[model samples]
Target: MVTRARRNETDPDLGVLAGRLLFAVQNELFTSLAKEGFDDLHPRHGAVLAYLDEGGVRATELARLSGQHKQVVGTMIDELEALGYVERKPDPADRRAKLVCPTARGLAQARAADKIMSAIQERHARRIGRDTFTMFKAALIDVTDHQRRQQPQ
Candidate 1:
């Protein structure tokens, strides 16, 4: 048996609730970054930043991982490069290809984002018991892993 919250009044679909929670978390992260003087950063930038590898990644690979168009990723990379967050260097393996790598400022921002995410997770654990939150996260991972395994490569 499920009980509805007074504010929500009714139960939301699981996917809808998940999406809302994700957006809320992202909004809070962006707000925190803005307060810390990263005012120019936007939620859309996460598409590129989140999937970036430590060494570097090719623009086309980044676009595929980010589920964004190649041109769009290229533009975002250009903006990030201008902002001193990332750099484009010629890929050693491919003379004509370029790899996007994070700069010192970008690494700092990544650290800050990690801290913010940890704080958010701690808050959620406190709100819904640590054990429950752990189980919930594990369940989500399992579901995603299962879906990934089922997909054709």
Candidate 2:
């Protein structure tokens, strides 16, 4: 038999709950990043930084991957370039196209962010039990994919 939990008037909706989780995680991630000498970075910068690849990516592709507007991603690319985190170069495949490639400093920052994020996830998994946390992550991924599919193109 399926049973639903009783709802209270004060219960948070999905948007609120998701926002709370995102904000908390980003706060912790950025705090650790600042300590690692990426103090210039803001949460908005994650719209680019988090989706970067060592091989390089086009600004349009980055925008698509991060779910941000192309203009916004272009602005971010400019900021990151000024900060010495990334640079633009001609794409070998298409000389007219520019590829955003990470600088040495950017690679270091990416490594640090990966380590910090892993530590955060490990802590949470430990708190909730490994199996439960794994299940929770899988469920979250499924929910996210479903919602994305529902969105109009």
Candidate 1 lDDT, tens digit per residue, 87-128? Answer: 998899998999999898888888888889899999999999
Which pairs clash in model 1?
none
RMSD of 1: 4.1
Best by TM-score: 2
How high is the lDDT of residue 106 in model 2?
89
lDDT agreement with native, every candidate: 0.85, 0.90
**Could you tell me how far off, in angstroms, the CA of residue 47 lies in candidate 2 after the best superposition?**
0.8
Backbone clashes for every candidate come to: 0, 0
Who wins the lDDT comparison?
A: 2
In candidate 2, which residue ranges exceed 4 Å CA deviation?
Answer: 1-10
lDDT of 2: 0.90
lDDT of 1 at 10: 69
